[model samples]
Target: MPEAYATSAVASGATGFAPTGGVQPILSVKHIEKIYGTKDSVTHALAGVSFDVAPGEFVGIMGPSGSGKTTLLNCVATIDTVTSGHILIGGRDITNLRTRELARFRRDELGFIFQDSNLLDTLNGFENISLALSIKGAPANQIAAKVHAIAETLGVSDVLKKYPYQMSGGQKQRIAAARAMAAEPKLVLADEPTGALDSRSATVMLEAMEMMNVQFGATIMMVTHDSYAASFAKRILFIKDGTVFNEIRKGDTSRKDFFSRIMEVVSFLGGDASDAR
Candidate 1:
């Protein structure tokens, strides 16, 4: 495991977020590996990747293209299998789960936010947010309550009655965020959540995600290439050549300062210049 880079023990302004004190990690990726191809040709997408995300902590994974950040996320999300090692979510070994069990585990324990909002074209914001609970056979009132609470927290309540076409990019994304958290999954995985939005919209979406972390107590592991987007995370794990090269925690630093630090690391890692502000 690479040594964590930041000095502070905990994230700055983590008052509302749940503490890791004496608690088991919400997600654990232990020396996991992913490789593809035959004897003559091999691709090491991920090599000995190991990390832990405590309850309510928000972590970012950043690396250059082909650095295996996406591969790592897929392995943790169980969309792709690891070549070796273990992944435990909420104390359950998902890598060893049967096909049926893995399906149930995904629906029950994981929430995903993608680059695109991925909202159903036919469903309005409220219906979209309620879909997960509806599939779980939750009662009408219970589903409504969960949707309302999450939408309100994400500041997307006003758009509940609107369809994706009727909302702004930021609004659509916020509603999508509400849907993911409505199920109150043990962990949320986000991939470039702000990638598709304009600067203003992206800022709004990031703020909503922050609320989801601090207010909703959701543990998130997001994969992003943009330093500005990554600044929102409490800590960052920088991947290089399929391994964790370094780590940084927010500590007492402000988001602006954290962003600068992230940019510095990006420079050191030979990341694309556009990734910086």
Candidate 2:
């Protein structure tokens, strides 16, 4: 097993964060490995994967289906363990936390968005958002204020009374995002957040996510296979065979140009066989 990345803890405002100075990463993965099966037959789910996401930065992870993108996300999110190496969040080693400690850490420090809306059908949009607070044992009066504030920021306040089934896919997703942010987590992890939306809806959701990252100083790491979606990120990491193969920053390029660059990289990874067809 490889050694974990060492970090320095520091306090910031009321957050008790130990941000890496300058380009210090809020989330760091160092030479991590995940292998399944016995010594005789092993499946390497991850190999030497390492990266860092700084506070308030937006990063995207891109790869083919089996390239370990989701695996890497899971490992960093502390939902899965690595066979070797380490994952640090806010300068704390989560890989060593016990199961219950990990649960509390995740609930308090991470927000998640998935391809599915994942909102409860029985709950109104506002109730759905408030439910997270309720589970966290927040006061009743505070839940209302918090839900309204976050919904307004997410542009979904008007539909708070509506059910998920009554809302458009975009609206449902917006609600999901609002719910995620209401908890005020240190890091937001999204897996193909726009995968189920139409192009227009996807655009709206992506814009909302970008807004959160910029306005709230929310750090985000999104895993996706779409160039269009990844282009919305300030930085992109391309993974291949469980390792980072390339990285690109937006720089001064337009979104379309950045998308093109992403596609070129994807094509290269595909051995010249890419494009949607």
Candidate 3:
């Protein structure tokens, strides 16, 4: 709708575009392709998918089952490899990195939150969050303040002393989010972050994610099937048949308006209500 990189590069039918708006994109997916199997069993999990996420932006990826949303996430997360094209994070071409370099790159530049909390039962909230900062080689003395600061922002400060089992579902997820952002990684990959929560808990989790993006300047890329969850993002990229189908922004619009547009796109994509919710 606007500039190709800042506003609607997807509308221009472009790929691998670097933003010209002073600030460079934090994550660039350059016509990445992921093909599974071979010969007669070939499955193109991703076909020339490309997008740029600017710094401090919250982006959502939505697609129906078998539409390659998860596959795209995995490829960006470096949990899976792409068959073609390149991926760059903070301008580093991760696709060309060696195995050891890839490990270090993932550790230093990436953060992840899954559908489940995935926190260790043995670790308290403070410890869990601290572990991430520690892995990034944060000074031991600064770790506590970082953990507390992020926890406070995400509304998980009250549970920092408690174990995962001792907190509510929403609290645990918030803590997981805090852990992901504790290192202040260049990009955070969230996969179905609110999937395990009930309606109320999901609302709280989404609010926490919003706070993480707005208050702490975290760059987040979330993959969610729920339109309600997708609405929380600053922009939504709809994928169909392994390609970006459409893109919309929440620019100068209320969340309700954004959600309405997302629903319309979902309907047009023939998304299953049971799965998208």
- In candidate 3, what are the lDDT values of residues 37-96, reduced to their tens digit? 979898888889888999998999988898999999999998889999998899988888
**For model 1, how does the per-residue alpha-carbon lDDT over 1-277 read when each residue is reduced to its tens digit?**
1133443332111111222476788988888889999989999888777778899999999999999999999989999999998999998988899888888888889999999999999999999999989876788878888888888888888999999999999998888788889888999999999889998899899898888899889999999998999999999888888888777789889998888888887887788634444
Which candidate would rank higher by TM-score, 1 or 2? Answer: 1
Error of 1 at 176 (Å): 0.9
- C-alpha lDDT values of all predictions: 0.85, 0.82, 0.86
lDDT of 3: 0.86
Residue range 50-93, candidate 2, lDDT tens digits: 77788898899888889889998999888789999988888999
Model 2 residue 84 CA deviation (Å) reads 0.9
Q: Which segments of model 3 are wrong by more than 4 Å?
A: 1-22, 273-277
Task: TM-score each candidate.
Answer: 0.91, 0.88, 0.92
Highest lDDT among the candidates is held by which one?
A: 3
Error of 1 at 127 (Å): 0.4
Residue 116 local lDDT, model 3: 95
Candidate 2 or 1, higher lDDT: 1
Look at candidate 3 and give me any clashing residue pairs: none
| Model 1 alpha-carbon miss at residue 182, Å | 0.2
